[model samples]
Target: MPLSVVDLYRDVLPRTNCKDCGFPTCLAFASMVVSEKLPLKNCPHIDPETAARCQKELDAQHAAGKWTRRDMAEDALQWAREKAASMALTDLPERIGGRLHGDGPDRELHLPYFSEFIRIGAGGIRKENGEPLNRWEQVFVYNHMAQGGRTNPTGNWKAFQEIPNTVSKVKSMRAHVEAPLAERFGGKAETLGRAAMRLGGRDLTNESRAADAVWRFTPLPRVPVMLLFWDRADEFDAKVTLLFDETVTDHLDIESILFLSERLTQLLCEDGTG
Candidate 1:
């Protein structure tokens, strides 16, 4: 049978977001393995025998042109593109929280993505500078457009686990999104706050909670995310919790939501890495 990214992620990988494989999550690493041909051994957690077997399977599939490269992401991207293409361009702004511009085949929806604006149109998604988005970015924005959700964000927030149909993804949320932030900005609440603000996040520490720091971000116009960080106090370890507006699912599926959080974490950690 052909090797697929999902197979590698669900069956072979540890699904722990250990970062031992130099990727943010097991899912991202799995995509790299199946799509970009990253070595399976890059993941130190895999046993020698299992790694060898999986490599053999992957190599055989590659030779036979049977490897399913980025199966889920590519499929979602295609579906989003077709869906967006089918929708009336003029109606996208009201539905997705963007502004419509131009006319006819050149029409585009300009939407806020984090601190930047992206133009989505017949040419697909691109940054304000006109650089094209990567596959994951495209998948996220395209999926948002395809959803055509018109509900406004309710100011109320909910944890990822509290969201409907999210049980299977809770571990992923911790491993990939919340855990990484806790690990990176654990005792550094001020640093974390600054990093977040650089990306247009607002400090909301005074509103509620005994957290060391609290911030909110509007990565997508309709999806507002709240991040709470508990600094490493005496006799306690640091913690990070992400809360989302109740209306998040109306605009994005669980997978895309996770990706959005992961992207925020990536941006927050960039300054430290430099």
Candidate 2:
């Protein structure tokens, strides 16, 4: 079996929160070594002989393509494709709010993804411009299709913790979606607002909570996400919070929702304004 990050941290590394390895924790270093291709020799505390043995195993695993993040993502996309294959293309228009085009083997659903659109067919998911989607984007769209989009947005928003079975993903929501936005747009509400609006988001600052900036976005026809941002204050860091419609799970699961929010962050940050 290939050595996982956890296995490397627990079985090989010292498991100390030592910063000697130029990482905040041994587990962080282990994760980088396993997933990000960080050299194991970077950890000064590990014995040279043990490091050699583990590095050799990691090399063999990499050579065999048994331990790679891209491989895992591709596997996930394949699984989602299988599930989405069973969905009826004809029914997707009303279920997910997309236009069906072509006929027979050339059929596909052209669904609005933020400000852009994507083409989903039996072959694969791609951008409306005929650009192929990455594994993560493909997985997100496929999972959305596989869910059948059973319900519409209720317009009632709730925090990430308010959603069922989402306690584990709260940290991920902050790290991947909230923190990055807060860091990028803190004290720059105008820039953030412009970027948000560029992606078809609506300004809701007047009606929402006492946030410095508030925007609601409909990435999908049925999936609405609201973002609330606060500028940095005395002794308090800036913050960004996301709220989802109460019926969001009816269209997408928690994992897909996280990915959706992360994608939103990516788009807003890529707007090149701030």
- Give the winner by TM-score: 2
For candidate 1, write residues 157-223 as lDDT tens digits: 9999999999998998899888889989877777887788788998888877547788899988998
Per-model lDDT: 0.85, 0.86
Give the residue spans of candidate 2 off by over 4 A.
Answer: 1-70
Q: What is the lDDT of residue 232 in candidate 1?
A: 86
- State the lDDT at 100 in candidate 2: 91
| lDDT for predicted candidate 2 compared with the true structure | 0.86
Model 2, span 187-234: residue lDDT tens = 788899889889999898988665888898988888888999999989
* Cα error of candidate 1 at position 73, Å: 3.3
Model 2: how far residue 133 lies from native, Å: 2.1
